[model samples]
Target: MIREFFKHLPASVDPQTRDLAEQQLVGYACTRRPDDFAPLVAHLDSILSPDGDYDEDEDEDGKPKPKKRRDAFFYL
Candidate 1:
């Protein structure tokens, strides 16, 4: 199933992005917890979605906010 998911990624996606997505997918799959799957899918959706920039968080001055480190999750 994970292979199928990676196989279906759009051809237009660059190699680096595709590689990152595949890595994240694999990491998520290793968790084997059903609940973790949704966030993994949501992350992939954000990457593939065309509506807006993937990095949407912003600060008060409208500048892009620094991404917070996910200390609890090694994959992150």
Candidate 2:
């Protein structure tokens, strides 16, 4: 899911994890079909710039919370 990739993307994550996330994102970015790629970009935008309010102090299992919903969906 996008949340997993999003989690691995932050600089705080281990370098190996970030590298794998980057590989997944970069591989998808090279897709020949714009239609297939668009949702990934849109989903990233949704997660990065979510539309609703958030409680910065909130944490789930000691990790920052992932947003609950978004309009876009990414496909592998």
Which candidate ranks first by lDDT, i.e. highest? 1
Query: Quick one: best TM-score, which candidate?
Result: 1
Candidate 2 per-residue C-alpha lDDT over 1-76 given as tens digits, one digit per residue, 9 for 90 to 100: 4454464343445667556656766788776465776667556545544543243555857887765543444455
- Model 1 TM-score, all chains together: 0.48
| Model 2 weakest 10-residue run by lDDT | 4-13
Candidate 1, after superposition: displacement of residue 36 in Å?
3.5
lDDT score, candidate 1: 0.60
What ranges in model 1 sit over 4 Å off? 49-76
Model 2, TM vs. native: 0.35
Clashing pairs in 2: none
Estimated TM-score per prediction?
A: 0.48, 0.35
